[model samples]
Target chain A: MEKKKEMVKTKRAQKKDNKWTQNDKVFLYILIPILILFFVFNTLQLLKGFYYGLTNYKGYGDYSFVGLRNFIDLFSDARVGKSYVFTFKYAIVLTIIVNIISLILALGLNKEIKGKSVLRGIYFVPNILGGLVVGYIFSFIFTYILPAIGQMAGITFLQNSILASTKSAWIAIVIVGAWQGIAMNTIIYISGLQTVPEDVYEAGMIDGATGWEKFCKLTFPLILPFITINLVLCMKNALMVFDQIMSLTKGGPSQSTESISYLIYNNGMSGGQFGFQSANAFVFFVVIVIVSFLQMKFLGGKEEQL
Target chain B: MSENMEKVTKEAVEGAVTNENEGEAFAKKRRAKHKKQSGPVQGKTVNRVINILLALGCLTVLFPLYMTTIIAFKQPSEMTNDISGALGFPAEWKFENFTEAMRVTDFWHSLGNSILITGVTVALCILIHSLAGYVIGRKMIKLKAFKMSYYYIVSGMFVPFAVLMMPLVKQTAQIGIANRFGVIVLYTVFFMPMNVMLYTGYLKNIPTQLEEAAHVDGATAWQTFWKIIFFNMKPMHATVAILTAMSTWNDVMTPLVIMAGTDENTLPLAQLNFQSQFGTNYNLAFASYLLALLPILIFYIVCQKQILSGVVNGAVK
Candidate 1:
């Protein structure tokens, strides 16, 4: 009798599980709408972007499909090449500068200091301001204030506007980018520092570890994950640089500062090279994917080793 | 009574002896040892040096803002070509610059547009993404379909917005939504991958037993989610709201493309459009920039604690 009852209970449970439940209804109710919107907005657009790359369709009128010609053209185009070179260079430099400054700021702020929160708030102010506005503000400084100071101090380099020169224009962008970029990165690092337990520092002290030694041995290893996060975030943001370039240089000084995104927006959308820029955008996408994948593999390996 | 009084006095004496011998002496020794150990790490000199460095850092960060404020108050005539003209306070405060800036940018209209866009985008992101996250988070463990869907959604994170820019413009125009409405929808969609990841990760810590209990008590899945699970995800909501709001508020590209040729303009868009018109009129331009910055700056100031913590939480996850 006991065996029969157990078998019957199992059969009932299986029946209930197989039957459509209210949970499934709720799940579909939520999932279907999101999937629909996702399809219409994201997935569909991506596929269309890929298709647009193969054609010579301008923004307005239709045109014949250009096949692999656009993609082929991307190889020999000097402007495209220049942009890629500029973008990669900017991304690398900005990433390094931002990480270093933010890390140092984080370390200092993590100490017991008066008005720590207030100081942090001040630093983070730039991050909250719109990029365009910040760009405009800094543009004025680069144009007016810096030059004035330069003239007053009799510094030849400072007397002229940096944005007007191709060689120094990119550096100005990096400075502004780093100024805003450091804020969030610093906050991330501080949080990482907070995660290192007091006991670990105590143990380090007991073992006669110096301040630098403790940071290197104890704090750095514990915060490796945060470093990876910051690095990846910083790299991705740097590569897609747009707004500051727009307001500051307009990709001018002979298009020396045209990032990949800026190029796409300028040429593809407004400049009526939609199909060609689409191909460029597609290539840019693949580059981002490969770069991100490599970063993950490299950084993820380091994280594991630590 | 005399016997009881004598016993109490003896116990008090014993307590005092134990406190002095064990507690006070040990505390003093530990305090001294702590000071000795922390001397190098937390020395007065080291702290003072760090503080001085930090103060300098703050000044550097504030320098541009200070310049902007001073320049905005100075007249075009007072804005001489020299450093003193740039650095010194305006001879007389020119509050008219702000009025001119407001008039030029249609400041109130664009401000409203920005607030509306940000508010709606944040609300929709929280609502749709959290529900999607909860469902995926709960069911992905048992269902293969849910797991695949989760991956499908999360993969959007790696795709850069530039790749989608041109195509999205054409698509939105085709769909007849290439306006502020379209921008809001796109913002919600753009933020989904990161927000969903955050939400699903948060949901893992919420115990399944609560849902099971609700099920046993004859509550429907909808009721269970709304009543129990939704409220449990407040911190994650704050994280999503803050991250989405910041990006949406400060964003320029989406509004620029989507709302092109429309009468509507977000704050950033207005500033960009009027930039050339305000060219060389540093006072008006600076005033306009400050006006554009004020809303988000004030928001940040009021919610600094939550905003900072929210960013940390979102980034770490």
Candidate 2:
């Protein structure tokens, strides 16, 4: 009788296990198809970009592989040349200014002040607005507000325009980009700042450290990780910017302000040089991947200290 | 009774002797120090100065929007000659610019296209990404190897939309979904990483025990998820939905690149087209841009609290 009872219990447990296995199998069947669709589609989309880069193909059905011809043409293309210069210049300027301004805002809000949250809200409001809307508003500001300010300052030449010239157009783009990005970056920096323990600050103060000393030693060093994350992401994003430029400048004043992405877009879609755009895009992809990889590696090395 | 009372009094006297004098002096000095620190009715001067400076900076940031609002309402002559006058609240408010802009830009069709595309994109992205996010977040599932796939997807965020636009356009042409909801779906794929990150991060904090319990209580996996896990992820859902909506609704690039040569242009692209139509008409262009931004701004304002709270809360977590 005892043997039979044990056998029954074991069999029942086995049956439950079988039921679970069946349930899991059913779940997997339902999920795997969807997962594969997304994965396969996205992977193909990305990989095809690279594959198409090497081809001397047009939009139609037929094409042949042309090894590095697209790249060679890319280097020689005057439009691509202008875009490269403009994009790099804009990225550098925008990255540095945005970081500094956001960091400053973060530090300011980090202090024990009244209405700090409200101040934060006010600053971050622009970020919530769509980039296109922000671009549109900036267009008017460039056309209208800056001129008025210039007039008030008695600077007649500056009063005449804000974004007509190549140099001025670049400046306007950077300023608008910085404005749009500052709020989120400020929030990220603030998040970083909060990680500095109060006791650490007190300890610094106990050592007779001044405010600046405390910030430089305790705050800045501690926030390096956040800085890295913010910097890399910002740099990558600024490099790939399109909407605002397309809206505000449209690579205007003779394509003086056209970035790589904008150039790729205009050439491929409007100009119908599909394969040429693909090559430009592939180069952009490689550049992004390399830069991001290096950034990750550098940060990875510092992760030990963090 | 008298002898006991006398003994108690003596002990109390000794206790007072030991404790009172030092305590009294400490309290007196502390009170004196507090009094000295408390100056009569003065505010924090440093805070005031700092706040004033910050307010000024914030105003400068907002100055562009303020000026635009003014310009969108002004007359063409005002816009041309006196940019300042154009950039002020009209002395006599004219709402006709908005009407004129709508009529001139075929605003209805453009608005409808934007709504359809953005709505479809947000819905599909949320659905697909949440499923993927859930799979990644719920590691108890047998598909544990899929976490690497999620990481791969996350890295896709770094791929510039430009890099993919060319091939994406071509691929869309092949798939025959280029101009319509195809661009919308592709946008979802491209933009999924950020939304996935948000969802997965949120899901991590939720204990798996809830779903397990629901499962053990004879619920199917789907039921357990929808009934238990999904219901619990309100904050994450709000954040993702609002953000996805905002981005898709505002996106010009995808429509510009993919939807080109088609009549399926969204609001931002329509605005671009509007610019072409009335390129030289500064008033009409400005007015159209304002019209494009208004509905979005309204939506954002209405959802502002939820969006801000969701982000702030997510950050805290």
Top model number, lDDT: 1
Segments in model 2 whose C-alpha atoms lie over 4 Å from true places? A1-24, A60-62, A76-78, A144-162, A300-306, B1-43, B140-144, B309-317
Candidate 1: give the clashing pairs. none
Where does the lowest 10-residue lDDT sum fall in candidate 2 chain A? A18-27
Per-model DockQ against the true two-chain complex: 0.54, 0.34
User: Each prediction's TM-score against the native?
Assistant: 0.91, 0.84
- Candidate models: Cα lDDT each: 0.86, 0.73
**Model 1, A96-211: lDDT tens per residue?**
99999999999999888877887788888888888888899889889988888787789999889999999999999998899889998999999988988899889898899987
Provide the lowest-lDDT 10-residue window in model 1 chain A.
A3-12
Predicted candidate 2, C-alpha RMSD = 13.3
The best candidate in terms of TM-score: 1
lDDT of 1 at A272: 81
Best by DockQ: 1
Q: What tens-digit string does per-residue lDDT give for candidate 2 at B207-256?
A: 86676555556788777776787777776777777767766777778887
What's candidate 1's DockQ score?
A: 0.54
lDDT by residue for model 2 over A1-306, one digit each (tens)?
566556555754775665445555655555566556656557776788878878877767688899889989988999888898899888888889989999988888877666777667768777766677678667866876678778888987678566898668888899888988787678878888888878987788679886589778888888887788778767887898888887788889779989898888887776767788888888888888887898888875663243
